[model samples]
Target: MKRQTHQLVLAILADLEVYLKTELDNVVIYDDGRGNEDVFFRITEKEHLPLVASLVKKYNGRLVTLTPNVIDDETHELVYHFDIEGLLINCTITVTDKKIPSITPILKSADWTEREMKDLFGVVPEGHPNPKRLILDESLAEGVFQEYIGLSDAMAGAATNKLWEHINEAKRKRD
Candidate 1:
């Protein structure tokens, strides 16, 4: 019975692919904790996001959230994470020449997710109207998040120097 249900979902996705225009690069399906099937797919740049949303609507699937991740390379690839009805679908799209396609036009919910990706991964959504810093503030030390990741491996002098810089900067600003 479970196998049959999985096959049915695959058929639906395959049908959606024809209209999607781009070939489905990859597909991953798993059972989410909520007893619904979770599906992830890597697809080409054809802008099938709204189609996916429509599928979610037809299936009564909830639109959970969207997250974008950056792949560090000469041409960074943007991975969009979509959670629909407990199923996580990750779509990876390549950006050549630092040009990222805007999904906010398709899904209004993609606004903030694009902003976060911009600040953290340096991937700018081309059509995002209000792209602003979401992670760091004015007072945050440059590369603080990156530095925090390496805090455990930082040498004593390096740590102290960074700390002193912050302290002196604070003092200088106040004085």
Candidate 2:
């Protein structure tokens, strides 16, 4: 049953590729050696992200999460995970100019995660209805996580502890 469902999803994705006139790179079913399989594909063009989101919704798939990984100083990768008929699909889009189209308009559940990618990774989600910071203060610079990568473990821990202290103080004042 799992194999058949996976094949059906692949067929739909192939149809989408043909309809969109775009190629999906690294289209494969990855097995985790633990009786789990996930369908993964990469969208080389960032513009196609929203269109894919719309199609996923039309097919009754729900957005699971959006994860962003910094590739280099000027490049990032955004992976949009979805669950369709109990099969997990991971659609990845590469960002070169630190900007990508927001899928929140198509999937409202993507709102907070998109904002989080913006705040933590500095990847701006253009067209997001509410593009405000989700986890970090506006006063602090964006991509705080990236900035701490070069720091020593102790230094990073200290910085994180200090930031948490500041956050706690603010919460106390608000209360």
Candidate 3:
């Protein structure tokens, strides 16, 4: 049942890559082997990102979320989660370029998700209509979440407190 649907999705993706003139092997799909039926795909090429997103949408896949993580001092990884029928497909892109193009035009829901990455990781989301801060105050600083980068204790505590106060104030305003 679920396995069959998963296989169908694989076939759909393969056909899509062929139509898009992309290398199907580059879209590597693998599971964690935990018998949990969760599937993952690491889209190995940067240029094919939008094509993959388009294919997912063509298959009626919905963008669940997008997340970013500092992969290293020089790079960050952007991951996208999409749901096709009952199957989940994940696409990851490792970006060394400070500016990555926004997929909002394709995913629509990626508007804020990419903005969050931009605000927190300092990875610029080029072409983002509203390239404004999503999670941090303009005064605090970007890349505060990067644990690899050392920060002074005074700065760290101050940034944390500022963030806390901002959150509380926003909540108060909402209420």
Candidate 3 structure, TM-score to reference: 0.72
lDDT comparing candidate 1 with the true structure = 0.60
Q: Candidate 3: where are CA atoms >4 Å away?
A: 1-3, 26-36, 148-175
Go through the candidates in order and give each one's C-alpha lDDT.
0.60, 0.81, 0.72
Task: Score every model by TM-score.
Answer: 0.61, 0.78, 0.72
Top candidate, metric TM-score = 2
Expressed as tens digits, the lDDT of each residue in 1-175 for candidate 3 is 1245556766777766675585555455555454234456566566677777787777877778887878787688888887777667777778887667777777787888787777777888777888778899887667666665345755775767865776688789979
Model 1: per-residue lDDT, tens digit, 81-159? 6654445556666665555666665566677777766665556677777766778775654323222445454565365
What's the lDDT for residue 86 in model 2?
Answer: 73
Off by over 4 Å in 1: 1-8, 32-35, 46-75, 84-86, 138-149, 152-175
Write one digit per residue (lDDT tens) for candidate 2, span 54-135. 8888778778999888788888878899877777889888889998989898898889998998888888989999988889
Model 1: per-residue Cα lDDT at residue 175: 100
- State residue 2's C-alpha deviation in candidate 2, in Å: 5.9
Worst 10 residues of 3 by lDDT: 29-38
lDDT of 1 at 148: 41
